[model samples]
Target: MELITLLLLACALAMDSFAVSITAGLSLKQFNATTMSRISVTFALFQGLMPVIGWSLGTNFAAAISRYDHWIVFALLCFIGGKMIYDAIQQHEQAHCINIYSKRTICSLAIATSIDALAVGFTFSLLEVDIVFSAFIIGLMTFIFSFAGLTIGLKLGSIFQRKVEFIGGLLLIAIGTKVLITHLLT
Candidate 1:
């Protein structure tokens, strides 16, 4: 893939991380630079690493499923994206939980949000792309955007939290469609 495509993929992949960071910021009462940095770094690392791991797994099985890889990517992306959208639309009705920034919460959120990236990594293995460069771009973009998102959420309040998730869901679905279309045309 070209650098531009890699960058776009990174940005698309970071949407979830960015949204989660915003929620974290909204819940933070005693936020500090260190806390934000830790969140960003942890998220970025996981986001970057999951794809590498997925790609490795995909690479091993690439020859076995090369003919149907696009379909697989499309299916996984659609499932994940659709689920995110569904969750967002349904989330607002739930009662707000008490705000807490424990180690467990951070770890849980980071893992939960980065699950989609693992799938993306698998997709990367099927495509003609640069894994190292793409993963790096993804990690860097996620870190920067997530940090900014948290700051923005801190200032803006949690009223628009659902909006963030909605946008993320839209982006993922769009990306999925694009991947499928490109594969079809090729």
Candidate 2:
């Protein structure tokens, strides 16, 4: 793919990470640079890694990955999103329980968001693209977008507070549903 096309693809792939980062920002009580960096970096790493994995798997397994990748993504996102909504509801009376800063949650979110990238990697293999360079661009774009999304979400959250988390959860579910629908339709 041309650089412009690759860049556009990167942006497309990064959308999920961007939205998830926004949700992470919404859950934070205060903005912490370290936390934001951790989240963004984790997302970047996964976003980068998934494509390489897909490339490695190559066309031989593309059909298999495509067959189930959307389902896996849907399950992960729905579970996490549902948990966020449930936590938000419970935290209305009690202290907030979901920690966006937690390593486990971060890893889960990263993996959940990057599943699509794996499929992209498979496409890259078929296209005979330079996987390393493409993955780097994807990671770089995801890092930038994820960081910006979190910052924006933090600003929005300052005005909206806890309700932002609920919205974030809904966004996640919406994203998951969109992924499923797109695959099913195609």
Candidate 3:
């Protein structure tokens, strides 16, 4: 793919991570640089690594991967999004307890958000694209977008407070649905 096309693809792939980062930011009581770094890096790493892994797997298994990748993504996002909504509603009093910083939570969110990128990597392999270059662009774009999303979400959450978590949860579900619909339609 052309560099411009690859960059655009990177942006497209990063949207989920962007949305999830926003949710993470919204759920936090305060912004911590270290925490943001961890979140962004984790997301970037997954977004970057998945494609390489997929490319390594190559076209031989693309059929197998594609058969269920969307479903996995949809399930993960829905589960996490539902949990966020439930927590927001059930523990409104203790809203600060949402642990967005935990390793497990971060990893889960990263994986959930980056699953499509795996498919993209497979596509790259089929198209004979340079996996290293494509993965780098994808990871870099995700890192930038994820960081920005978190920052913006923190500001929005601070202003909106109580409603932000619910909104964030809905955003996640929406992203997941979009992914599922796009894949099925295409």
For candidate 2, give the lDDT of residue 68.
76
> Can you give the lDDT of residue 34 in candidate 1?
87
Candidate no. 2 TM-score: 0.66
Each candidate's clash count = 0, 0, 0
Local distance difference test, candidate 2: 0.73
Worst 10-residue lDDT window for candidate 2 reads: 89-98
Tens-digit lDDT track of model 2 for 43-143 = 99999999999889875755656667677657755765676566455534222244786899889889987887786676566556899999999999999
- Compared with the true structure, all predictions reach lDDT values of 0.77, 0.73, 0.72
The digit string of per-residue lDDT tens for model 3 on 46-75 reads: 999999987787667656666776765567
lDDT of 2 at 36: 91
lDDT preference between candidates 1 and 2, better one = 1
Q: Quick one: how many clashes does candidate 2 have?
A: 0
| TM-score of model 3 (CA atoms) | 0.65
RMSD in Å for all candidates: 2.1, 7.0, 6.8
| Error of model 3, residue 69, in angstroms | 17
